[model samples]
Target: MIYYETLSINDAGTTNNYITIRGAIDIGHNGKVIIDGQNTRSNCIVIEQGCGSLVRDWIYVKNLYLRRAAAEAFYIHCNVNNVVIDSLDIRENGLEGIKIIGNDDYYLTENGICAENIEIKNCTIISKSNNLYHEDNCVYVQMAAGLNIHHNYIHQRNKQIGVPPGQHEHVDPLQTHVIRDVKIWNNVFIIDSSVLGHGMILGIQSRPGRRDTVIIYNNYIYAGGHLNPGGNPYINGFVLRWYGYVNSVYPPTYVINNTVVTSNGGENTILQEYAGKFYNNIICQLGTNGQNPANYGGTPLETFASSWNMDKTYVDSVRSNLMWRQWTNDMSFGGNRWVGSGGSPTGIINGGWNVWTNSNWGGTGINADPLFVNNVRERYGYVIASNSPARNAGEDLQAFIESKGLPWADIEGKPRNNTPDIGAFEYENQIPVEFTSFSATYYSDKVTLEWMTATEINNHGFKIQRKLGDSEWKEIGFVEGRGTITEQTEYSYIDDIISIQTSVLAYRLMQIDLDGSFEYSDVVEVEILPAKFDLSQNYPNPFNPSTTIRFSLPKETRLKINIYNMLGELIETIAEGTYEAGYHKVTFDALSLPSGVYIYRFESDSFVQVKKMILLR
Candidate 1:
């Protein structure tokens, strides 16, 4: 809860109850700090004690600058829990922008605690300058578990900056960590493997345990602007350094839904583990034109293969699929795509992105160009656009074979929209720019309204509209749109005036495109419960489309409800307005909605709920 607001205040100082920070400090003891460096020097704050044991307790450092430190600019060694550091401009440090390092031993000493539940996000961690002392990575995490790393732009350019070439010469590249059961998603890593460095520039590693697992999905990792050495330009595609054997009887590792692009680097293997299940992945080598004697190829499958125990049962499980008649121990393949060619019966049968055993491996399913939206921009932003074929193309093979429904898929095993494409891309109906996802939030004054779009191709913006009972809808606010943007966009509008009249209000977003095209998200209901909102199940089960919707009014509210068809269509309006108090309901039979499956939403002063019903023919 204390702030150290001096550029020179060191962690090796006389402060134990205060958090020593540099630049504008806006952090709270209630558990959040917003450090404003005014976008000046990189060294916003340095935290490394002369002694290893003298680390702080319960601190969250964020939104600052730091440099000339032995480790990351925002460094921590204490065994703190429920801590998060985010939204900063960090660069050019002795180490990474943020470094959270601790071991089981460090935790046990601090009240028998362990480093658990930590998150780092929305920060720019870059290695723009290559100092021999600045050991790799924009961020580094060690021995920490229960972590969520997302929404950060990390780039490692060692050659651009002058760094000598040696074994331990260049920085480790990008964010490097060793942890278990971690989720790394929605981040971008543009690694320039010029100075013969490691390719795992940004990743979370699991120290092999019987139950160890790392779920890496929706990430873009590509190598460019680097020198590709013959042996190992990018080096090991992904390094899962197993220190000891996993003796527990748990399942193998899980690698899914990632798009990895490489150049002259070494071989690219999704599952480089002693044991693991590799599925629903896309690994490509955006090969360079230059041919070196060491030039393996534009995409020389895997130049250097990491050693894995062939005797392990992992290989046996892969071959058991029946499709691989003679699948071998080393499942290494050369340059190829996942989808097979359009051959006859025995060609590309199995529904998975197919890699090849050699450059000549053929199949009718392989796409010369999987058709990515922006290859260059995507090279840095690791997430595929919503329109990308890789979005939901992933086959729920594991889920199906296990006789289980894929909860994470779009719905009902429908591949994104219709038939799925190969690789990670899933080309759903182009998510229009004017299109938005229904959203409702409770605020101090009034319930807030909002929506999100994956991409806005020609979005002119949005208009906030409200309706009461069966009354006609009217525009309340005009939101400026992006006109034309390629990235996912978010917009919000609030109704403070409605709060004084009633506890609930009905609202919707009227998305308007620049060209005058438009679309609407299903109406979402916002209920203002207590601090925590309880979403209630819809009422009048099996009733026609005109069922009465009801919910408890925890507080004063603005509410809204929009009905949609099985085809994701908006058909009816149950209600939208500021309710006085208590429980209430609105009716709307499918006098207008078609006879099929439809979803109706209820948004209160603070909460939102969605329910589905069948309009039995």
Candidate 2:
């Protein structure tokens, strides 16, 4: 590991400027790797490998603050592979924050090598200027495969100084060319055209040999350039510009589960060419407020039409229009909510196009308000309220992906329930009881269930239910609630009649309110053992002074049991000698010890096991 602290390099006069690295290396910083150009020209850092080097892979660059680069901040060139740039703060760069260029010779060769497996994650890039000599961007990648750009906050903050309004055009924050197998997800982009002098542009340039598998999902983008005086509005959010190559097959682009808000300017919020599928997206235009005018942007009713046999004339007209980017009938849009304010009820103007009222294949199209928790000017909170129509309005994307045998999850890391919410956020209404922890343990052929709640309101009690294998759930017993309370409470129940026929059992707590309303807690599963050595969790864990420890033995054997503190110091010998062939229990008294976690060990001639127990006084 090479660490740097406030290191400044000045290479304005040298042609091979900046710090160049080769081979597999890990470069990090304790404070910051400050590379100040002092307004002079130079690249910050460069990583390159020779054409046929055998020892080049896995270069990690992290925890650095790069600023004021005359050219690009970090330049990754030539045949370097497996590059990871993470946790970087790159700001006020001249040309680009990071530029990745593949060797031209490699692309021309029959089986030449290209840069592969590049990942840029958890970074903040703020570019205020577009280089006068070069087309500037925050991050530019050309000729790469398996690129993942996720969880980064990128914004272009206003035009460069001395450039007049409209003269300073903004570049894309993230632009790529000829890259394949790409996934851009879970990023927040807040772009102001006044400050950045350009709208949010997510441009992808596809070429031959590209896998055509690109996914842009779960992003929150606010693109508006109305703040720039005498400047055209930069309202576009995402655009896919194909290189127009006639391949026998084209890879499909998937645009799904994104929340995009465009307030002013620009032609369209989302525009795609060639083959694409748009699903479960929330596209909002601030000007129209959920109403679209009749025939807006010459949008005929057939534009919203969907069927196996599309209108040939309408498709031909769309293909002929250059403004539509040669869009043919090869695109499919569904499960999307287009909300704007204007026009009639069935249609709305969205980025120079008409939003159809008809649902997509997933039956998802709404023009009503999402009823966000706090959605105000410049402070857009996309969280849906309890009463918002977006709740339970989402198509089951998990099911859809499962049908295709693909793995997927929601933006918030929550597994998609049977019915998902419409927008990026899944609304989770608060339950009457707030459970902190729940667990189940088996001992002596009985299952002991325990749970703790941090708070409760108007609670009647809980119905204990159990299920065996694929059988029906049966109500086992009930535990009385404390009615209404804010303090943490603990409860436990035991089911002695666990069916001996089943090897697995599942338990859940159904909390009932005073009004008879109820909600079920997540199920906990337990496995029934078959005459093997096993140790069960201590009952009433975090006990004041004493607790019971249970264990089972398949055959008679001499055993020794001892308790030890967290520091591995023997505290007590609860049971030094055991004379049992079946289930046995021992009482551990910790009246003299302080509150902390302790470990218990049971050892015999052929078997040994250790378990942890908490003691709280």
Tell how far residue 139 is off in model 1, in angstroms.
Answer: 1.3
- Judged by lDDT against the true structure, how good is candidate 1? 0.49
Candidate 2: where are CA atoms >4 Å away?
1-35, 50-56, 103-113, 129-134, 159-166, 194-211, 246-248, 265-267, 288-355, 358-364, 373-381, 399-408, 430-617
Candidate closest to the true structure, highest lDDT: 2
Q: Weakest 10 consecutive residues, lDDT, candidate 1?
A: 319-328
lDDT of 2 by residue, 144-170 (tens): 766888878787554443445545555
Poorly placed runs, candidate 1 (over 4 Å): 1-71, 104-114, 129-134, 160-177, 199-210, 228-232, 245-251, 265-271, 290-305, 308-368, 376-393, 397-425, 435-617
Go through the candidates in order and give each one's C-alpha lDDT.
Answer: 0.49, 0.60
Winning candidate number (TM-score): 2
- Per-candidate TM-scores read 0.51, 0.52
- For every candidate, C-alpha RMSD to the true structure in Å: 19.4, 18.2
Error of 2 at 411 (Å): 3.5
Residue 335 lDDT in candidate 2: 19
- Residue 72 CA displacement from its true place in model 1, Å: 1.7
